[model samples]
Target: MRTGERRPTLADVAAEAGVSVALVSIVMREAPGASAATRQRVLEVARRLDYQPDSRARLLRSGESRLLGVVFSVRHPFHDDLLTGLYDAADKQGYELTLSAVTPRRDERTAIAGLLQDRCAALILLGPLAPTAELATLADRLPVVVMTRAVRHRAVDVVRTDDSRGLQLAVDHLVELGHRRIAHVDGARWVASADRRQGYRDAMRRHGLEEFVRIIPGGSGEEDGARAARLLLDDPPTAVAVFNDLAATGLLDVLRRHNLDVPGDISVVGYDDSSFSALAHIDLTTVAQDIDTMATLAVSRAVERVAGAQVVHRETVIAPRMVIRGTTGPPR
Candidate 1:
């Protein structure tokens, strides 16, 4: 093949192997019509020419793409972990994943549109920001599974950790460690924010520490955590429950810079035991959302819907567990 030339096609393989294009197609698909010897010869010739099948075209022709479109944010560390789990789960179920990222420049609409253009069989959106009405409209078109967020619509299926319960676990853990003055670094108005915030409040009330319940306005990123840390310095709580691992890491950084010893001086707990949280250096005490279970269930749901199965549930809420690490202790 000449440099910069187009890749070899099925026709090229057929011509070289002295077989009809139809025979080549049968061999390529490993269909029953092709004899074993013919299949072996055609495959060998195709290998010699470095011929690669176009999966998209093949799936399109077969009318079963088996493509699960995942819309995730590029910024979240937990999203990366979720993607890894989704890939494994999808592969197990004989499905492929098409990822569309919601970057700073690209909006959710654009990312979702790209997936639609690729003819994805179902959509598995990670922490989607779209409204319920919008999601309902999308569900009407195709099977939609919203992950890491709660939405109630007959058409939409949701698979998410119980955010409120997750936060309650964080607060309870902190309190059990003898932390009376507990502050929450909140993800203001973001998906799952309200539930976490409410969990914090409810846990505080349950512990009879309502007066110590202070919510510092924050967000889902490290910068937001840093900003909240700066505010906490003036009237620091005995312990803090951060929104997620990313924000918790930021808060940890700021606290270290200010010579504050974690747990010793100010115990810190974060939600989402993401891969980063388990790092040797971070060892963040966090709420563990079973990513593997969620991913597997999401794929199963998407596949079942794609195969025209009747799905009764609109939402699947997974329970969150608390992973205690080096970050939490009895506050000084």
Candidate 2:
């Protein structure tokens, strides 16, 4: 607890509480993701370890102008995961993230404008929906690093997962489970949705399940999955690969409500492997985007550009991995 000694950190508290650093962060920030019991335990661990977050202090000590503005969607659980990593990355580089959230009512423009007003040293956008020209315009003003989405603009640095590969991985897993009547619930019109959709098609064709290729209209939220589930009920597939975990949760809920035993009746797969996927109740088999690598590279690129370093590459694509969980099973 002494000031001169190395201070306890979120990692310390997480280790003590048998939880993840991300969960510790959520507890520390009083975020909504944690359960009340878990929150109490995390708080006790923090108090016991004297763990205090120095991120804000570090930012203030460094300077107000050293902030990295980050634009992300509030609705995406994956964004929350990346935010935790982004904070750690920024902290390592003596910078802090200033976040602008995109809600249902607030558009990306509004989020970006808020960051521009903050006068951050650089901007790192997470799966931004802005057009190439708009991103280019923003890049002309300052360094911009887009994460979790691909862009062709020379001025922008993109750090994203091979989203297509993520879908392919999911499809492959389901196919390996001897599922032929496999369908996909796609991320409709989202920036990364197109690649994910195509990946599904490619994976299905590669497995000679081309005749089984069916795409259900889905989106980035639980509601979208819930709606898609209704359609799926008419003629259910043996397995389904969803666009993302958020949507997958919705689909799971609806399927369960209809007395369908997951994996026994219809196996479900999701992308992003967001924290909730690992929960015992959800236990979603999913494809994981490399959040740590993506965040580190995104921040690294943004910081380098801010430091006036020469751009080496315009984009970085991290690989995806499949997480085998209880949600997936051989066709019944």
Off by over 4 Å in 1: 1-6
Q: How close is candidate 1 to the true structure, as a TM-score?
A: 0.95
Residue-wise C-alpha lDDT for candidate 2, range 212-293, written one tens digit per residue? 9999999999999999999999899999999999999999999999999998999999999999999999999999988888
For each candidate in turn, the TM-score is 0.95, 0.82
lDDT of 1 by residue, 146-254 (tens): 9999998888889999999999999989888888999999998788999999999999999999888899999999999999999999888889999999999999999
Each model's C-alpha lDDT? Answer: 0.93, 0.91
lDDT of 2 at 39: 97
Give the worst 10-residue stretch by lDDT in candidate 1: 55-64
